[model samples]
Target: MDDITRDLVTLRDYWRYAISRFNKADLSYGHGTSTAGDDAAFLLLDSLDLPIDALDPFLDARLLPSERKLLAERIETRVTTRKPSAYLTGRSYIQGVRFHVDERVIVPRSHIGEILFREYLGELGSSFLPDPMAVESAVDICTGSGCLAVLAAKFFPQAEVDAVDLSGDALEVAKLNLAEHEVEQQVSLHEGDLFAPLAGRTYDLIITNPPYVDHEALDGYPPEYRAEPRLAHDGGVDGLDLVRRILDEAAAHLNPGGGMICEIGSGREILEEEYPHLDFVWLETASSQDAVFWLSAEALGVE
Candidate 1:
């Protein structure tokens, strides 16, 4: 608590100091947008007495003495413990959409957010397959916190979204995120491995950010990996375990002319070498990730 005014001011000042120290650590092997310091501040702010929306306004105002101290404690706990700020706060954001997350699901950081939110995908004017009246239905296979599924629904309001995951806990978190956006009724949460719950259903688009880290890469990952679910990080020996499986099975679930897109991590080169027989287009994003690829049902040899 602050000595003069309130606890909020004290917390904010303390977090700013803690974040500086955390970011100085080595984080070369992990893929996270916010520095440790940035995360620490977020954690501190989340532990406050005010409404979540008050964060921006509070930062704009001068801090009171008491608010400073409480924030310091929050920062110290997170920085010293080496936990993610998203886990500490139970929330994370991608493309300005807030998601409820926990240890059950990896933090949402899909580069697909750039494409989906920015509407870089093809126009729906010519789309009439799923239904002439229906815009475009989508499947978020390997959906973790269901961030991409929600994004799909937002971008394609006329279409419904189905979010499928193997982890029940992760789906629970995903359900909350879908509901938070008032699209819970629109999104169907299915529990099963990728494309398993999908069965004979077809979609205009299938998206995934499946586990694609090679065993060696996982072994050498920075300390940040220790905080995330290993199931979401380890992609087997060559990192193509899940990617290959997805590519092989996804074609069966896509409508004719429909495609599947996945974030393949560093396995892009290996995939190219392994699947020279297939035709796929690897999409480039402003996020600078190179492994995202899309394959049509016909190109992948699926009926």
Candidate 2:
């Protein structure tokens, strides 16, 4: 057990050492895939009543008995159980934003996080929505952890965000995250399949990172994904089962110039084949994640 005091240099070295060992040891079954080291570090910091930013300094110093015990137990758990660090700590970050996550809700790792962080989508359909507060009313359908809804509020300060999810458990996690960011007042939580609870309500923006993983792909999802709620990851046969339904009725829920932003996973190929005549701007992002489409109410045949 390395002594971890308030020394910055030593702390950073120790943290890196632990991270490297965890990575090499394959302590987590989901290791090499998720940020297991970060998870372990977070757990340690949390147990010591220390802040994450203080990690560099603490690792350089010698560890107190309590701290050593805490880390030892955590390391043992990680090495022996192959459990994901997020599940151990019960939280995750997306786009530098902290989001409360757990088995109830899938961890927030969507590529859309990059778009939101870059403010790309905010401008994509800006022409369609001329109102300065056009995004004042937005919906994050199939919102898990309410990360997207919270980001919408953060980006569009005036927006009243609605986050809907079919799973009560998922909603609970989303609620916690929303409240954590102190955006509870700016966001509303609804429990039901997409759009079921919206009724007559309409929004200027509808952003979603819905279940777009096809049944086949879903079945083969890594163990980490399997641990997440199926309702949050399964998108049916072609991966657009729910997406098609959302698009079919989405126009009705969008204000005249409003649009919906959706991440279609690998369904891009399917969407292109199915809606060749429709005009949807497929926004590109880092990596193979290339199926996000923005559609206006008009595009959906909504009058």
Number of the top candidate by TM-score? 1
lDDT of 2 at 83: 54
Per-residue alpha-carbon lDDT of model 1 for 156-179, expressed as tens digits? Answer: 787778989988988989888888
Top candidate on lDDT is 2
Candidate 2 structure quality by residue, lDDT tens digits, 86-117: 66666666755667677787767776667666
> RMSDs, each prediction?
4.1, 4.1
Count steric clashes of candidate 2. 13
| TM-scores of the candidates in the order shown | 0.83, 0.82
When summed lDDT is taken over every stretch of 10 residues in candidate 1, the lowest stretch is: 125-134
Global CA lDDT computed for model 1:
0.71
Candidate 1: regions farther than 4 A off: 1-12, 23-37, 44-60, 64-66, 120-135, 301-303
